[model samples]
Target: MQTEKVVNYIVHWLKDYATQARVNGFVIGISGGIDSAVTSTLCAKTGLDVLCIEMPIHQAESHVTRAQEHIKQLKEKFDTVSDTRSDLTPVFEAFKNEVFFDGDQATVDMALANTRARLRMTTLYYYAGLYKLLVAGTGNKVEDFGVGFYTKYGDGGVDLSPIADLVKSEVYELGDFLKVPESIMNAAPSDGLFGDARSDEDQIGASYPELEWAMKMDEAGKRAEDFTGREQIAFNIYKRFNTANKHKMIPIPICEIPSNLL
Candidate 1:
């Protein structure tokens, strides 16, 4: 697929979303990864005020540097930049003391990562309110609506997602066409939860290509076919769709009669 076509599609999609939401601008938390870079720039192409927040915790020094490069690129192309960060040490420690008494560092890291994502979402909303913009989600098709690699009530929360239909590899393709800095594009995508934690690939045990293949299978209505050796990858994608159930439907009501539904 041509990258320019993808960019045009995203720009048009964002325009439609903006008109529907009655908002003139968009905000994204740029983690210096290919996905966010692509999303932020595509929104900019629509002439929307795209604001990027660099919400890196302690382990994300490299991403912080990358965020600066992303900011420079955004300034050249977009309307504004909101370089923001919140250290999660205090909040992490407090939660650790209260509930994670004997938990390992990995557990602490997971909790902190989710917390960091939630904080960034809150910050995005704060700016959105001030600027009359919507909090744009940077999640890709493989990450957000597909496999659900985001935290609920955190990165998963958003007013709109410009790149939710593109897979991870497609995101990189678009980023390259947009001339997003090569460093951010080349860096292995990470959530910056732990200082040197395993990334999506390591955590999932399947590369992006493999995951994308499974996603295609599911998309083509082939989910029930037996694929025994690939159970892990299937399980990961399955969990993603399962947990993102909230995004797929309305909140659970106390009682819903069939008559009421009709």
Candidate 2:
């Protein structure tokens, strides 16, 4: 891909879309990950006001440090870039106190993790509305389209996605080009939703390069049986996530009444 050209195109696209929508700027959550770093930098390049928010709910220290470093660099490089940190740990604790817990430990833990994401989403939107800024999403192709690794209505909620079309490797390319903080660029990819340093590979059981290959193979109509050994294992892992998370990728189901019934 033409990296410079793509960057210019996305910058122009963001400026044009925001101008057309009559929004002043963009608001995005900074998670200290490559996708967020790349997307936020692109938004900054647009010369529009880009508010980088660090919303942490029981977040790991490494993630928080990287997020702060990236935000600091962005602000130093771009005049239009500004940042604010919102610590939401209390909010999360309060929420847990109010909600009834059910199911096994795993299920309950998963729900809480998702709750953290939703809280961050809500925080972003609150600022977006208060400042008339569009909520910029940081999802990439692999998470947004291939495996649907994001929580629906949580991190998935956004006014625009600047980097959603780019895959994981492409996002890393953009991050490198954008001169993102070295700590962030070198750090392993993680969601940071679990308040721990569990990498995305740990969660998915496959590296991004492997997952990208699987996504391409799946797109090319290659099934798991077509490969054996490691390839098959990776393919099956990809297939399992892609199948289970299909709901997040597709449009919400709607009930359409018959003409006569209407």
Per TM-score, the best of the predicted structures is 2
lDDT of each: 0.74, 0.93
Candidate 1's error at 23, in angstroms? 2.4
- What are the per-residue Cα lDDT tens digits for candidate 2 across 13-51? 999999999999999999988889999999999999999
TM-score of 1: 0.82
Off by over 4 Å in 2: none
lDDT by residue (1-262, candidate 1, tens digit) is 7888878987998988898888867888887778888888887788867777766556557777887898887787655544555555566567557664358977766777787778778878988898888888888877765566788778888988888878888888888888999898889888766656457777656667777877777667665445656765564556565465546433546765688678
Q: How many backbone clashes can be found in candidate 2?
A: 0
Worst 10 residues of 2 by lDDT: 172-181
Badly placed stretches (over 4 Å) of model 1 are 79-108, 220-254, 257-262
Local lDDT at 259 for model 2: 97
